[model samples]
Target: MMQELRSRKVEESSAREDVHTAASGDQVSTESGGRTDQLRTSGWAAEGPSRPWCRPPPCFSPSSDVEVWLNRLNDYFAANEVPQDKWVAVLKSFVSDEVYVVLAEEGPTATFNELAACLKKRYGSGESELMTWMRFARRRQCPTESLEEFADPFGLCNAAQTFQRFIDEILHGLNFAYAFIDDILIASKTPSEHDGHLRELLQRLTNYGVVINVDKCVFGAPQVEFLGFLICPEGIKPLPTKVQAVLDYPLPKTYQELRRFLAMLNFYRKFLPVLHERQQEGRPPSTTSRRSRHRSLRKV
Candidate 1:
């Protein structure tokens, strides 16, 4: 506490360099679909007519250049007698926007100009080169960078029906880092009131063969250390990082020391609520035990 809030900031926020990818598509019809009226009443509990692939049913495997990979997916399904939910999930990872556009453009074999125009109209920047976009999506299937955001034109958080539709946008050549995060971290809990999001997470984890260390874990326990933070029941407490920050903190014997400590925990003050008001910044928090009280002796 006293040593380092006064030192230099450690985690400096640097501007990320202007960064990268490419995609092509026409202006996507952002209009509400035929089912809009039915889906509007309740959150996700609304009753609706059944439709293939739009409902919770497994997505159909389409023939494409990706068929080789798809075959492996089929084998996995056959090899594992997982629950229906997990089965449904692995199946969902197949279809993607790149697949759709590739099949669409290849069959009709539209002129480059037409394809570009359609892509631009549907996908703005993606229209400049539809094939390029498709290849890029295939080449880099990492969901975040792909066109998933574009698929739902109208973002619907609870729409399982839309999951296939949205996922189709970026299901190819998947980068899958976030997928790992989803399995290991996000899904390792009980279902919340939010339509069993926890179940969905764990379900996905099951598909990926991801396991949670139960003894090391706090099942449904709020505030476990993940990647290094106390993700609490209440909210993200980040206990490990805070302790680290304090332990790693420099002494504030000088004015500079205060700034350094501030930099370390500036983003974390909410968790370290005691901060200055509680006079918690005097000693290094990690090593704090008993305060040495000085007895003032009066000359008799």
Candidate 2:
């Protein structure tokens, strides 16, 4: 009986030691009479009772509407056990600079509700119909040139008709001024003549409440960059900025990368001398050989 009691006490001591080691974030095991027992550090030891911590939401770039991003943010908050009051910092971190600017205007001490309200008010429920129309207008199948022809869809659309009417009403007698959808190109022989024409154009615009963005408008310049093209006395050329973008592009290694590089080069093919030679130079030897093999197989 005495021997059994001592053995039981020793077993309890060994179990206590195992618990202590496990609490200290260490895996522990005990062996007695050829039997083994293991204790793994889990729950409280490593993560400390699952306490709430500030978890930043996924990054929201400037591309999406505020409502869509906010919905995602709300989901993140709920999932991460983030409190409503602590959301401003996370929101600021997750959103774009444009969104952050608007938030800042709402004030630094603004609460999550205030931030959300401000975003909703500023960005609206989502993008408007006019905004959607503008996006569609900007899209071009070919980047080389965008021709605004008064054809089928344009003729049929109410927006186009309204735009055409607006142009006709605004510059009814101005024979020198030419307007095409969003682009307005003014031509004059001399700088002085150009200034007069510009002043007249500005006056008409001002009278009609057509506000122009000064940053986007150019007046009496020797060379002007417009619609991704640099226009000068010599000829219209691809913008130097665009050329620099191509130059700064990284060398391609993978098949996808090679294709992307070739596609970009093709955009400015006219400006690039002996583009066919470059295509030949950039083609991988293995790819060319594979194509030759395929051709031979087809013949067979």
TM-score of each: 0.27, 0.37
What is the C-alpha lDDT profile of model 1 across 1-300, one tens digit per residue? 632432212111111111111133333232433333333332211222332112110111121111112122232122212122332233223222111000011011122344345446655773345334322222211111111111111222222232232223222233221121112332222234322444554454344323444444334433334434443444444566467768876555443455566677656565566676543334334443333211111110
Candidate 2, residues 163-269: lDDT per residue as tens digits?
A: 44444456678755555444455655566777677778767765653555455565666665544555556655788888899989986645566678879878767
Q: Rate the local accuracy (lDDT) of all candidates.
A: 0.31, 0.42
**Which candidate comes out best when scored by lDDT?**
2
Error of 2 at 91 (Å): 45
Output the lDDT of residue 30, model 2: 23
Error of 1 at 34 (Å): 51
Pairs that clash in candidate 2 = none
lDDT agreement of model 1 with the native: 0.31
State the local distance difference test value for candidate 2.
0.42
